[model samples]
Target: MNISLKFKQVLNASLLKPLLASFFKPYCLLCVAYEGGELGLCKACLSDLPWHSAPQCPQCGLLSNGLICGSCLNLPPHFDATYSLFSYDFPLDSLMQHYKYRNMLPLASAFASLFHSYKLNGHAGIANIDLIIPMPMHRDRLKVRGFNQALELARLISKSTNINLDYSTCQRVKFTPPQASLPLKERIKNIRGAFSCQQNLHGKNIAIIDDVMTSGASLNELAKTLKEAGAAHVECWVIARTLAKSNY
Candidate 1:
């Protein structure tokens, strides 16, 4: 008997959801409301979250009304485009902090579902995408965190969108200081030589999945590594973006 992928996913979700709910009833983490929907957020709180509202530069993905940024014009990053789903602010930042630092692993599904909504609402550039690569956490960091949040997100996205994920073909070779902690001038240097790509992805367009895009230093470095490994196009699909020009 042959089973379809969608049917299997639905069956798995149907089976596991009840078992999960039996242990802990679903509730919104932000408001303690019993109104958590499919995305683990109530409609009110979900709408209130800082969604990215400004028009963005096609090349850099920064809010600039489609104008190319100077960085893209003068020294273009290896990535072809960046897609940030929400603005990094307020409760969103708090939620992200809790998810990454407080071990809120279940929130990955919420983030991925939110991205799917964005895609459905006419941001379906995902069709042009060929592969998904989550930003790698170095062995030391992975051991410390016990999980790579990006990879967790990539799994959900791959399942939802059916995009092929290549997690084993790249690695975080150098564990550098967190980009959020460094100044913009120092951020690039910190992430330099941090990633090593092993895949021979000639002519394929891939997106690196991450939770937040702050300075973009890490993503740019990873894109550089991927391009060197022969990926035709590299893009980013981040949950949030810090709109200001300063490093987060």
Candidate 2:
């Protein structure tokens, strides 16, 4: 086997072994308090989490109870639908920053569990998805980070839902300015035409996975690219949504 495949096999074996997990419990990256349980965070932290309970815009995934948020209703996104697990605030935002920027990879799995635990109620229509595609990073950024947070979350999600995870099906051709550093309009411009599909996605229903959604520009661009590549439908699955300033 190739070196990369061998490493992946070792990592998978380590992740699957309960005894190995126990031995590394105290050092677990996501475990706020390793009390010998499998859950990374203590029950208290889990219970007090600021989960996304408000209804959201069916298009952009912004928190809203109405048919759609004003922003989305006025201007629809390329993606057909969006869903998120938590609101981007306080402890959740802090945790996400750590996971995304600080290389706390274990937190991805914890966030995935949060996404898996969410019940769609009667919205089963939105939950039945075919494939999970994480937003791809430019080659340069991927080299620096060693892993994509979105891909890590997607892996956990795939394990939970038994869904297909296609990491290399989409490629990011541009190494544009970081979306967080740019204005909303600039962010959209930066990501436009940045993504392309390498494999056939014709007639496939794809769910774009991401660590968080701020302006929704990246997801919109990706969805548009997928649609152009003959994807029948595109949905977004995100870990957190940045609430509007008025709601805060």
Candidate 3:
């Protein structure tokens, strides 16, 4: 064997194989240990996750079984309806953080599976969607992250649903600060006019896919933009939703 090829084989046996083996083994992200699946979360951790299965607002996807949550009923959101796979809490929140800020791409597939498992119930199926638009990230943020987590999730969803993915249709017009750092009121202002539909969406039932929904401000703003651009309906599909804080 050539010297270079022999050295390459040695490196793979001594370093690469062991490293990859450790990586593939299911180690829980919350608590370090073998989980059982590629999710890196054990069955117990998965079961303990705060899944949102309660009654939800038909419009904004808030957890209220009635026709709408108080916030949505009084002042309707721009999006016609919203749905999420899980609550933004506990281990799931941690998982999202890793995926978004930490650039953990593998976790995106796990999240997609959760979204797929969500019972549509009376909700519209992917067949009803004319286009799947992922919430866009500013150029600066996109450059730094290399990839948008929402887009990653959307790709997986499209593969499963066979819906048309339209990444270039909706574009981010401005670079804004992270929404989590801003106050609730500021979030709306920050994202206003931030997104614009580049392609005609007339009579199209669009579905906006996002990784998280905190105050629903960003989604509302994007939906409003699509509506003005001639979209017939705008629905939201998110991976998680931050629970509302109780008033004292």
Score each candidate by Cα lDDT. 0.83, 0.79, 0.81
- Could you tell me which residue pairs clash in candidate 3? 55-64
Q: All candidates' TM-scores? A: 0.86, 0.82, 0.86
Worst lDDT 10-window in candidate 3: 117-126
lDDT score of model 2? 0.79
Please provide, for model 3 over 1-28, each residue's C-alpha lDDT reduced to its tens digit, 9 standing for 90 to 100. 9999998888688658755666667566
Instruction: Return the TM-score for candidate 3, rounded to 2 decimals.
Output: 0.86
Candidate 2, residues 1-248: lDDT per residue as tens digits? Answer: 99999977886795566656667664334353556235477776777777877867777766667477777766777888878788888788888999988898768767787687773333476456778899998999989988899999888888887879998889999899888898776887788799988877789888889988888888888998998888889988888888763110
| Candidate 1 segments exceeding 4 Å error | 1-24, 246-248
Compute the lDDT of residue 29 as modeled in candidate 2: 40
Q: Write the per-residue lDDT of candidate 1 for residues 1-248, one digit (tens) a residue.
A: 35797767775796777656745776776786777777778888988998886788766677775777766777787778878888899999999999998789889999998887784346557787899999999999889899999999999998888889989999999978777787887998888899887868888889899999888888888998999888888888899888886331
Best by lDDT: 1
Between candidates 1 and 2, the TM-score winner: 1
